[model samples]
Target: MAKSTSGLSRKRMGEMYRTMLRIRRFEETADDMYMAGKVVGGVHVSIGQEACSAGVCAALREDDAVLTTHRGHGHSIAKGTRLPEMLAELMGKVTGLCRSKGGSMHIADVSKGHYGAHSIVGANMPMAAGIGLAYQLEGKDRVAVVFFGDGASNNGAFHEAMNLCAIWKLPVVFFCENNQYAVSVPAEYSTSVDDISVRSKGYDAPGLTVDGMDVAAVYEASREAVAHARRGLGPSLVEAKTYRFFGHSRGDPHYGMYRTKEEWEGWKGRDPLIVCEKMLKMTAKQKKAHADAVETEIREAIEFAENSPEPEESVALEDIFA
Candidate 1:
């Protein structure tokens, strides 16, 4: 069941709506670019899970850090990553945040404390826990937030990372954006228990559930979790129960295969963008204006990406360590 969010203010609600729009437009462009071969190595689209990214990002401070998965564009956008650089990175251009060496799945903007994203399933969780450990050692309160899917929660790395964070009392928040599928495997078939949150008890961390469709619910939950971590409290886990409108990746045809058309429609009707727009009290005209602005921003970024020069061959091994 989607969580209730009735206390959000008009301004904050408007921001959430805009952020969703930004993600939608940016991803739309990415899809087109992928089809055109501009975005190399392909990408996992986050067309339906905007709320989880935008909401959780809103709750993070500038000093906070995050690690994301292959389906990471939304997370990057939510962290205020510059659209031009992100797009350039996807294009493998020199102007990219990663100097075009890291391409789509490895875009990193450490300036934003994003610490980069990972293509390997369940791998970033351990890295995020390590970041938390470093912060503790340095006597800093920076919290490390790791985003993964329900499928990742079942991996050995997930358990190991959770145990490490727990034993160390690390300031890490393991936020699982469970979109109900792990690349065509429905979550119901993968896990014995229904809710992923319950697994946190094994690590002695507080487990929580939030409305991944409602950006406000995610923001509230993330805010509380981050505050606790910043206070030197131990790690926590948040299972955002959400659904993905698209397939797990650009190639997977999720519609009418694993789920029914009716199920997709039911979730789409409650699109987080629409939810936030309604909460902002914005009429159709106002909503359209904001949406158009976001679209425009994305368009400029795409244009910049298309025009950016690709990385030179000489630098292929620049960042690699033997």
Candidate 2:
């Protein structure tokens, strides 16, 4: 795991690595809990695609906003959502980020700038467009990023949102986490566009693609794209072509039922954590120490989430509207 020392500070690089590791471990823990029948509902783990989330999020300001997909925990974690609250939301606890109402698909912390995660494909793109519009009208420089899959790129909202964002020069970044599939369907089947990034031109926006497995590459790409939007240069589309080592949700096996064995093995070999570790000039002991500390922190968060009480029966009737 070699650190891209070109343009990042020590603290920034370290934070990026830490965020990637956090996302990886969080999804791993969620997977284990789901298998043990502790976690409820469906979870779209972003195991193999952590670099896309961490890289892009690393470039965002605290005030910038983001919208996520069902496989959104990575973005939430990267955007600074506290783990205990997130886990509690997954467990349906009263203190959960979404107050135990949104569950896995809808878990969001508005205060953290994570607008919300939706299960409906391509639904959030338009919402993100509207949010960007609000920011522009309010005279705020803040930008919004939308995380979606390749299948979502084909949806009508994707086109409509991009059109609106480009028309008004809204500060938005369309981040397509092209993890090769939309659930069980492959991108090849869903799209005729050779590259998702090229589709950005249709909306008169800049489009770029990066190695989604490489966190450094993603961070660099997003930094520039976000900077462009912040300069009021209009929007950009980034296609992070990564892979998923897990199923669409917790119930499916990692071994691909729809994909080939060779494809899975190929992507697994380039594990983001391994790549990051190799780049850093640290001894195995130091690497282990860092990983252990993070694991301990996550363990504590999980414990807190588990011990926390579930939502009160009376809460079921509250927070339904503004």
Q: Which stretches of candidate 1 lie over 4 Å from their true place?
A: none
**RMSDs, each prediction?**
1.6, 2.1
Inter-residue clash pairs, candidate 1: none
Error of 2 at 103 (Å): 1.1
How does model 2 score by TM-score?
0.96
**lDDT of each model, Cα atoms only?**
0.86, 0.87
Following a full C-alpha superposition, what root-mean-square deviation does model 2 have from the true structure? 2.1
Instruction: List TM-scores for all candidates, in order.
Output: 0.96, 0.96
Model 1 scores worst on lDDT over the 10 consecutive residues at 1-10
Whole-model alpha-carbon lDDT for candidate 2: 0.87
Give stretches of model 2 more than 4 Å off. Answer: 1-5
Q: What is the lDDT of candidate 1?
A: 0.86
Tens-digit per-residue lDDT, 150-183, candidate 2:
9999999999999999999999999998988888
At residue 208, candidate 1 shows an lDDT of 89
* Positional deviation of residue 315's Cα in model 2 after best superposition, in angstroms: 1.7
